[model samples]
Target: MITTIISQTANVRDVQVETIGDRTTIFRSRTWDRLKFEIEYAQQKGTTANSYLIQSDKVALIDPPGESFTKIFLEKLQQHFNLASLDYVIVGHINANRMATLSKILEIAPHIQVIASKPAIKSLKEVFGQYTSQFHTPNHDLDLGQGHRLQFISIPTPRWPDGLATYDNATSILYTDKFFGTHVCSDTLWDEDWKKLDHDRRYYFNCLHSNQTKQVETILEKFSTFKSKYYAPNHGPVIRYSLSRLIYDYRQWCQAQQTKTFSVALFYASAYGSTTILTNAIAQGLEAQGVHPLLINCELATPEEITQVMENVDGFLIGSPTLAGHAPVQIQTALGIILNTATKNKLAGVFGSYGWSGEALDLIEGKLRDANYRFGCNTFRVCFSPKEEDLVKAQQLGSDFAQNLQKSKKNRPLTLPTNNINNLSSDRTEKALNHIIGSLCVVSFKQGEMDKAILTKNISQASFIPPGIMIALTQEQKTELLPEIGTSFVVNILKEGRNLRRYFSPSSINTINSFNELETKRATNDCLIFDQALAYLECTVEQITELGNKWLIYAMVNHGELLANTGITAII
Candidate 1:
């Protein structure tokens, strides 16, 4: 009889590939909701949990999902197959609660046998109860009558306490619990094409791309010897009959990481903006010669952020200004946190300004060296007011640091293409805009109106102005607004009173109502107004371009909202 395979979720699939007389089954389990931690990636929008089943003579179930999904999984398995007796349960990784759940299965099938690696058996006993007789090594194969058998292969994953890969010799299939899988979600089990495969592989490497590269490469090399037809990983889908492509990609990823030599983190604290200027100059100099620098502001750098940057950064540059013979408190706190948590193999440099005693740079440099950080170059110090010579020296220091980075480096930077926004909708546009605004805090607008009195009152009451309102004022109002240019200000509307009356004009009011109606139609159809507005260019009406037309066509290019500025001589 031909065994059937059922795909339940995007990543999870039930495989019933049989060999000889006895039938075996596999189910790929989804461990994570989305592939990566955050939801920025496009492909990981709707990923599911994965698990696998093996129905040899002795029915074996591999790694199961977390506690949240186990009850449903058990019910589904019982509905399809006989559960009176289970012969073996294989523990791929010695995760405590996952394998310990075997006891729950034993409640129904008390005669079940459990198998794992030598170290895994110890871990199981340590975390769960001591069930010695049932626990055995993968060196022994479980026989599934009539020439079908299941074998265990130990692939040491140092990152995990005890990790092993299970092999089904009958179907030439391998069960890699966490290895050889990417954080990609797809309804299709096999990534038959290069595009999907490449995307998943890159995601896998970039996420787990640190110290496990070598271990992953070793596992791939060992598994390449087998004539494998499918790979049912714990997290993602099964690979149907194509192992060479994944192995090739894994090798390339590992080799690339081995060649990455040096990296730097540039942290600056700017109160009067001089530090920002210096930091940008240094970053530009580093980038000109192919050096990667993780630029961060000392005031904004949190412990978690600093720890992440320290993982791969090979050098550090701390920039601050003197505050009463000491570095700024924020900069000092950030540097202190980094120094305490930082690992070895990183260098440090310090630069700052002082009015009196030159103490801030020296103090920062001393703290860094006390933490055993290597010195990149002599600490580049500047006086109370930096001159042309001081700036030039700072630039040279950056160039020299870049040279040092090149000397220690072996790999090229990973290149990812920019995402296209042509087909994006208004809701998604708003979300992206909100994210950008939150991060950069820069707002600009061409035309909008708010009373100057309201603006001034709000600013006086509250420390900061809210975003997205342009105050219309006259030339005489310039003096009142000059102080708030970088903060908030009012701009003069030249044709003021006339422009105000034009907004209420009968013709202008009719045009505005029509535009609002068009907007409503676009929203109902789920079509973008930007596209509809752009379509108007092809209307082909000669009279629309007449110079004496009273209507002014104004496009809010950034927001894609349309407005018309009217005058008798205005062209449509």
Candidate 2:
């Protein structure tokens, strides 16, 4: 149903209100044409700011959107109810962006008490100072009225430690502030045809929850205990019919991410949410390689957490936005943590968004490079905000870095085979092996949510009877690695001058938007098929053997197609 504007003020502000339940009404402030810049929203989809109004014996307001919707939101609220009648104003979380609108509400409703989680209470005082004395901090629940009671759940993630969700027992609806939300702006009040919204929903999850899998799992488990029938998230359509299915999907996705052995510590501080856009894009790329990303928003993260995560990760990436001419204090503190705690040779990356000068990016790059650290990709610097193309580039760069890390681990002397040159006297067999170069191809596979891939010059037809081919992957010394026998993979043949090999280079692995420049599609076997390649082969591993420094696997071809007849196969 289309939302008709309930109020339009002299300043040309638009606010639409619609009743969803017996006493619950939603005030939506829409921003439909603001998608050209970088943001937390997936695909830069436009968003609607949804604020709820609940009235019973006492009236309560839940989560006011930021200053952008402040004037219209307040105007619409005044038309429906008296300001003095507002008994409580509930804050789901605290951030600098929402302070302006929140302060405006407090000014008009002086007698209204502020309600929030324990952590949010502290932040309220820090931001609002003297005015916060009248706030009410709920331990677990609050009684709004006779039948309209509210229960609170503190769901803390690294990004929002003060996050709170409110449940109304009378209606079985949960006011999920940040959880299970998408940025898409729609006229529909409920998720009626949720199947059609799958892409946007999954994109939102990938951007926000993918890196916070462990925390997501804990929160999902908590949510499972509640008998919530409706999920009224802060943005997008309210979930009713598909709530159970969405929760199940979230659990499965988070489990796959948490089970990955490879991990990267992604440290970033977003001043205007620009840096956050880049961070999300990078994390998405890592996820595709079965590499878990531990994301920390430095502004909200503790020093202890930062130090611990950095020490445990296989690689670390830092991003900051330039304020004036240098990095923010929080980012500087994170940099110190990295220098003091992380290994010197650990793979590192630097990126930043800036308005004028990009000194922050240069500073991070110089510091890490001087310490003899290896960079997974070139330093990323974008002016104002990143565009759609920029986000894709960042993702590919992340994937390339992951592939390089896997290659480096395998090539290390610890994994060298018994027939390695060190074991064999510089013999003719070793020299002959170097001359016998196979076709250069990208082999990728996916099992559940875990994805694994490698760039190799070791693929050749093994037999015609079963239409089989063989691939020799460098052996990994560690037992935690992916690529087990019986796994399925796609072999993408590379054509000359395609430059796909640049992404797999160990010296400078390009992780961001690696696939953006390539023409690709998925095969029947679910492996990626590059349209620019000489040919593509989809196969499943039927047998495996250890062949000097590699795991040789023979696979029966499930599908094959030639993309270009003149496209010469790439050989190393």
* Candidate number with greatest TM-score: 2
lDDT of 2 by residue, 222-260 (tens): 888889889988878889999999998899889878778
Q: lDDT tens string, model 1, 60-170?
A: 777765554556566666766776766777778755347545656767776667788787787666644645666777777777665557766677642343677877777
- Residue 288 lDDT in candidate 1: 43
C-alpha lDDT of all candidate models, in order: 0.51, 0.73
- Where does model 2 exceed 4 Å of error? 1-14, 34-36, 39-45, 118-123, 269-278, 285-290, 298-308, 320-345, 353-367, 381-572
| All models, RMSD in angstroms | 25.1, 21.8
Query: How large an RMSD does model 2 have?
Result: 21.8
What lDDT score is found at residue 111 in candidate 2? 80
Candidate 1, superposed: residue stretches over 4 Å from native:
1-22, 28-43, 96-100, 263-345, 348-371, 374-572
Candidate 2 lDDT score at position 267: 92
- Please give each candidate's TM-score: 0.45, 0.62
The clash numbers for all candidates, in the given order, read: 12, 15
